[model samples]
Target: MIHFKTLKQANHAFMLLIFILSSLFLSACSGQEQTKQKIPIKDEKTKETAVPLVKEWKMPISISADQGEFYKVIGWLSDQQIFYVTNLKQSSHLYLYNLITGKSKLIYKTENPIVNVQISPSKKYLLIHSSPSSNEGLVTIIDSKGTELLKKTFPSYDLDFEWNPYNESQILVTKFAEDWSFQLNLLDTKDASTTVLHFPEPFIKWINKDEIAYLNWNRNSPSLDAPLSFNGFGTEGEKTVFANIIQFEVYRNMLMTVSANKQDKSMADYSFFDKKLKKLFSFSIPQLSNYSDWLVPFYDYSEGKKQFITFKPLTSGDADTYSEGFQLIRYDLVKGSSEILLGGLENVPLSVSPSGNAALMGNSFEKIIDLNEKKIYDLKRND
Candidate 1:
């Protein structure tokens, strides 16, 4: 029942639940800038801009440190804008905040706590999640303009999504239950149509346009490793691609896997493979025993820069007690070089900017890293 090593289950949390839904909230809306909030002068020359009292790098609309931060940043839409989640009153709201303009626009709002918000691979659409109950999941797909495209509810304890790299309109989803029962389906976002894939594995990732790979594990006999298997999208198939692999992820046409070295249990090897599953390269990282059993470090992959990035601790130790912090390391595939982007930070959830120019780190995304300037800025601070 664990997906991608493990999942941190929020205790009986968050939803915008409806049996069936669409166009009901903001029916058939188009993309447009908000006319309310700030009205600029028609004659540009007549408008005067005020000078700032704080550093230019601070958030346009700041949240206080005492409020128990709720906002979780998704990522940067552009250098000046970002998408993040926070609750307003009893309702959860997604906001598009402009760093330069000091404007925050309501993108989406719901009475239920917004469980998750993810942008499409092309950055053209968003996938939002809300669970109405312990066994139900509701998904809302919208455009960058915040216009709702499709919405549906599923009978699931957990719902996982893997967006198709080749087709932004298609998605592979796994609906899970409390008892570890799951159903995998290929979903077409355009029509809300789905094709049920008859596969045994609960976790899967798209290997290519026509094939998908998954960690095939024995339910009856659990182990530290699983067989990496591949199956064609349209065919009923079975093929073991690799063995003794802990985890795998696919970015565009490249496949990456993390497996334990036979000779060393305390170290992990990351292997990169092309579309054909041919090993292109590999590297090693010291593993924290906290990540010892079934976990990996906070990591992200950037296809734009062909880099594998991770928050590596000073040394392999208990992941729970290690306060020495971590180094934000980036391994470049093209140049075969490793660079430390940032250091002296705990291993929190790492979300890199789409342009690879910045990263939001720490609880509530309270810390921001200017990847270009090599500067770290505090988003929320005590005055």
Candidate 2:
């Protein structure tokens, strides 16, 4: 071939070899650029951002003690005033502390111990309850000035009650019947009048001052597939709102429900409905490896923001160490993304501020996170 090839043929063969080499070189360079781009993205995803440290406040002298300890935060009445319970010298007392003044006032004192305390929405009344034993308890309504308005004794079995959010004068109470079924009643605080409703498996919630919504088991239904329904009952009469519901919750003005899936019993469709039971949006969450992991919604229905908070475990171990504990994540519904607020919060949050800007957390110490600022403050006792 070397002896017989013409000049033109040799030139053509040399150009063909050059074209092949050029293609290979270009491909290799492009692949290297792509690899370099991918590595930075992977690194960015894995990098952990440092949690910012904000201002720390000394635990007001009111709740701090050397011998006794503060129990749990009841709630925040205002940005500066907080309600909490404490046990000192074998007696429990409710105390209201002012953050600005660094002073605390005794709201109520008791020797039997305050089991739970719920403040009214107006912050004028406190609903206090205490259980003498496992089977007996008493509910008392007291003003912020410690004036008793109403006190009633209730049996410990199947006793559940909720205050009417719209009207402080009324409350919805539930008790178990002899057959282990639950009964719902509307209680009037002025005259102690109770009107029993003819609803079974009643989970009552006040939609407004004049309206209420509840979930009931549909025993009259012929099909087993749709055994539960959500209903609105009041002076207007009872009307079925939604059906085939496995779980439902009424938060502010929005209704959230989980519908049962016929094909896959383990799966469910969670939907948000309006007051009229019209579906707004729907989604499904994945199965959790640990059932104890919490997926909670932090929606400000008043403002109509769709946000949620989730607690995810970092490991499969029993005890969550400092470096390997549960993570607190704030998720945005619109963006479909999540941001880690805290990496190793050992315990669930105590309370989220009404404005949703801060959360109280800690086990042995008191820590407050300014959720909006992404900063945490360690609260210390001012000695």
Candidate 3:
């Protein structure tokens, strides 16, 4: 999901943050700030609600602000174990922490700071990415135990990866040069062989077992939205089924998209569809008038709860000018209703826990949210 080839990047911190997050959702840590904003609710249905925390504990990690060291709460390896990384300038160490035992095991170590770390869809393998040069990247693939399986390097200025949910051993990797020239390869980890996948777009997600979808942008024409196109692995040709799609993401069984609302160009429509490409439902968020340059906010979908959550502002405005922060919203896919959960926080990245009970927030993963309890707690070093 993190890519830097677009004209929109322009050496912005937000663009860099998005890329770092997309690279296997590299995990975060720091002196936790409790600067949560208590913005007033517009309606009674989505008003503020408070509940006492049932459980509270420090995250088993620390940060050295003096040294500019940081960390990320990458994701939950299991309900009890969290996968994280301590990032220093010269080195980075990946760890798996067990909440029950309050212990962490070193998974892997790299000489350069880890830029990205990803777990396979089934949680069977780990992929760590590090940048050793401006145009070269080193990748380390390991099993769940941190046993090295493969290490490869790519000559790319930017990169994106998609783990085939149906085929855990096969990975789709796209490598892009500084000029935005790119190549897509289907990697067979078992044999170290790659088959060139001729795709036009750099950002593609597996829509189903064999089919992949991408925003088919006509780079020459440079339109605001692209056709959401699809192609199968064994098929020769491609098909453009939907139009005017700005962004799209595919999760376990849910396919999501962001596009300018057909009825109102000022609103960005968020829609969900099944693997069959059947439209499920959609809602809209305020979008800037210039749809082409609109920077969509961060969002994460919870597979277990069938919930779509994102940070959104109440009013549409310029993307970067808003210092007031956005509200956290949860759209229930099953119930077809939405609720405001939290508000007045920067547009930072967030990932939902697999169980859908908690979420880790901030670039450093400095805050933890109790989704069920409606509370946010600082995530700090246990010591």
- Number of the predicted model whose TM-score against the real structure is largest: 3
Q: 22, model 2: CA deviation in Å?
A: 81
Off by over 4 Å in 2: 1-56, 60-68, 176-183, 217-228, 232-240, 243-246, 258-270, 279-284, 289-307, 310-327, 331-339, 344-350, 361-367, 375-383
Please report how far candidate 2 places residue 14 from its true position, in Å: 94
Better of 2 and 3 by TM-score: 3
lDDT string, candidate 3, 1-383, tens digits: 44457547467677676676765443322212222222223333354333223254445454455323447767777655678888666888888776555676878888876778888988889988988888898878998898999988888997788998988888888999899899998888998777888988877888777989898888799878889998998898899878888888888777888998788777999988886879898999887544356678889988889998899977887765656678999999999999989988777888787778788788877677778777877666554
**What's the C-alpha lDDT at position 85 in model 1?**
77
Worst 10 residues of 2 by lDDT: 294-303
lDDT assessment of candidate 1: 0.75
* Residue pairs in candidate 3 whose N, alpha carbon or C atoms collide under 3 angstroms: 27-72, 28-71, 28-72, 28-73, 28-364, 29-364
Q: What's the CA error at residue 160 for candidate 1, in Å?
A: 1.4
Per-residue lDDT, model 1, residue 166, is: 77
Best by lDDT: 3
- Which stretches of candidate 3 lie above 4 Å from their native place? 1-54, 60-68, 289-291, 380-383
The global C-alpha lDDT for each of the candidates, from Candidate 1 onward, is 0.75, 0.62, 0.79
lDDT (Cα, 0-100) at 249 in candidate 1: 81
